[model samples]
Structures are given as structure tokens and as C-alpha cells.
Target: MSEQRLIELEIKIAYQEDLLQELNKIIAQQQHQILLLEKTCQLLHERMNSFRLENNDEGNEQPPHY
Candidate 1:
């Protein structure tokens, strides 16, 4: 291939690499957020279980809806 064509191809390849890097960074950030959310959910679940146990200890009264 001609030198100009080769240079153009190289430029295109470089742009693609940069784009790929940006996408990877975005994905990493999203993964981190997901992990944080999962931890929060786990903590909430634990808290709810503790609350339920506490309520049970206090006579296990039925709710108004029951």
C-alpha cells in the first residue's frame, strides 16, 4: 500500500484504541457503582433482618394489616 494510505490506517487504528480505552474506563466505573449498590443492598437486608428479630423478641405482635 502507499505511504499515505498506511498512515491513514495507522491513524484509524490509534483512534479505535483511544475509543476502546474510554469505553473500558466507563465500564470500570459502572462496575464499581454496581459493587457499591450491592453492598448497600446487603447492608439493608441485614438491618431488616435485625429489625424483624427485635420485633419478634418484643412479643411478635401482628401488624394492623394482619
Candidate 2:
């Protein structure tokens, strides 16, 4: 292979390595964010269930007009 062609290939490889590292970092960050969102959703679901139960108990009470 010509010296110029070898140099070009090395440059391309370096750029690809950098790009892979950047993609890996982004994937890791996204995974962490997804986990946080999942936990938040679970907490919100629990709160909603509790609120519903409280509201149901209140709904059975007699009104002031009765």
C-alpha cells in the first residue's frame, strides 16, 4: 500500500474510535435517565392509588343537606 493511503486509513480509524466513545457515553446517560423516569412513574402511581382510596372513603359520607 502507498504511504498516503496508510495515513488516510489511520486517520479514519482514529475518528471512528472517537465517535464510538461518544456514542457509548450517550447511551449510558440515556439509560440512567430512563431508570430515573421509571422510578418516578412508580412513585406517582403509588400516590395516585392512595389518593383514589382516600377519595373513595370520603365519597361514602353523608352530605350536609342530608
Candidate 3:
């Protein structure tokens, strides 16, 4: 291949590699965010259950309408 053509090919390959790395990083960040959100939801659910149990012990009037 001509020298210019080889250089162009190298540049293209480098750009593609960089793009792939960026995409991978973004994917990792999104996964982390999803995991955090799931944990938050789980905690919220637990808290709600605990509050309900506590309220039940006192025989408080059930809140009108769920």
C-alpha cells in the first residue's frame, strides 16, 4: 500500500479504538447507575414495610384509601 494510504488507515483505526473505549466507559457508568437505583428502590420498600408494621402495633386507624 502507498505510504499515505497506510497512514490514513492507521488514523482511522486509532479513531475507532478511541470511540470504542468511550462507549465502553459510558456503558459501565450506566450499569453502575442502574445498580444504585435498584438498591435505592429496595431500601425504600423495606422502609415502607417497617413503617406499616410499626403503625399496626399501635392499632392506629387504617389510613382511608390505600
Candidate 4:
């Protein structure tokens, strides 16, 4: 293979490697964000359930404007 062609291939490989690393970093960040959102959703769900239970305990009080 010609030296110039080989050098071109190496340059392309380097660029591809750099792009892959950048993509990996972005994916890791997105995964972390997804995990955080999942946790927040779980917490909100639990809080809502607790609120429902509390309301049930009160046994449907009449509206304050009643």
C-alpha cells in the first residue's frame, strides 16, 4: 500500500476513535440522567400513594365550602 494511503487511513481511524469516545461520553451522561429521573419518578409515586392513603384515612370529608 502507498504510504500516503496508509496515512490517510490512520487519520480516518483517529477521527473515528475520537467520535466514538465523544459518543460514549454522551451516552454515559444520558444514562445517568435517566437513572436520576427514574428515581425521582419512584419517589413521586411513593409520595402520591402516601397522600392517597392519608386521604382515605380521613374518609372523604365534605368540601370546606360545604
Candidate 5:
């Protein structure tokens, strides 16, 4: 290959490497966000279950006709 062609190829490879690094960082950040969201979802699910149980206990009251 010509000298100019070789330089062009090298430059292109360098750009690709930079892009790959940036994409990797973004993926890592998204993974962390996903973990945080999952934890929040679990906490909300637990809270909802507790609330449901509390309501069920209160629901045991008989009507006024008793």
C-alpha cells in the first residue's frame, strides 16, 4: 500500500478505538442506573405488600348490622 493510504488507515483505527472507549463508558453508566432502578422497584414492591396486608387486616371489620 501507499504511504498516504497507510496513514489514513492508522487514523481511522485510532478514531474507532476512541469511539469504542466512549461506548464502553456509556454502557457502564447505564448498567449502574439499571441496578439503582431495580433496587427502587424491589423497595416499592415490599412497601406495597406491607400496605396490602395492613388493608386486609382492617377489612376484617363486620358491617353495622352485626
Candidate 6:
């Protein structure tokens, strides 16, 4: 290949490497966010279940004003 063609190919390879690194970073960040959201969902589910259990325990009681 000509010198100029070889230089062009090198430049293209460099750009592709940079783009690949950036994409990898974005994917890593997304994975971290997904994990955090999953944890939050689990916590909320636990809280909801606890609340339901508490309400069930009191479900048979009458109001003070009744």
C-alpha cells in the first residue's frame, strides 16, 4: 500500500479504538445503574410486604371513635 493509504488506515484504527473505549465506559455505567435500580426495587418490595403485614395485624381492630 502507498504511504498515504497506510497513514489513513492508522488514523481510522485509532478513532475506532477510541470509540470502542467510550462505548465500553457507557456500558459499564449502564450496568452499574441497572444494579442500583434492582436493589432499590427489592428494597421497595420488602417495605411493601412489611407494610401489608403490619396492616393485616391491625385489620381486625375497630377505630377508637367507633
Among these predicted structures, which one has the highest lDDT? 2
Model 5 misplacement above 4 A? 62-66
> With candidate 5 superimposed using the best TM-score fit, by how many Å does residue 51's alpha carbon deviate from the native?
0.4
lDDT of 4 at 18: 100
Compare candidates 1 and 4 on lDDT and give the better one: 4
Q: Per-residue lDDT for 13-64 in model 2, tens only? A: 9999999999999999999999999999999999999999999999999998
**Candidate 3 residue-wise lDDT, 1-66, digit = tens:** 999999999999999999999999999999999999999999999999999998898677766685
Q: What TM-scores do the predictions have?
A: 0.83, 0.87, 0.74, 0.89, 0.88, 0.89
Compose the digit string of candidate 4's lDDT tens values, residues 6-64.
99999999999999999999999999999999999999999999999998978788777
Please count the clashing residue pairs in each candidate, in the order shown. 0, 0, 0, 0, 0, 0
Q: Tell me the deviation in Å of residue 10 in model 3.
A: 1.4
C-alpha displacement of 33 in model 2, angstroms?
0.5
- Quantify all predictions' global Cα lDDT against the true fold: 0.96, 1.00, 0.96, 0.97, 0.98, 0.98
Output the lDDT of residue 32, model 3. 100
Predicted candidate 5 versus true structure: per-residue lDDT over 1-66, tens digit per residue? 999999999999999999999999999999999999999999999999999999998899887899
Question: Residue-wise lDDT of candidate 6 within 7-33, one digit each (tens)?
Answer: 999999999999999999999999999
- Pairs of colliding residues, candidate 6: none
lDDT of 1 by residue, 1-66 (tens): 999999999999999999999999999999999999999999999999999999788766666687
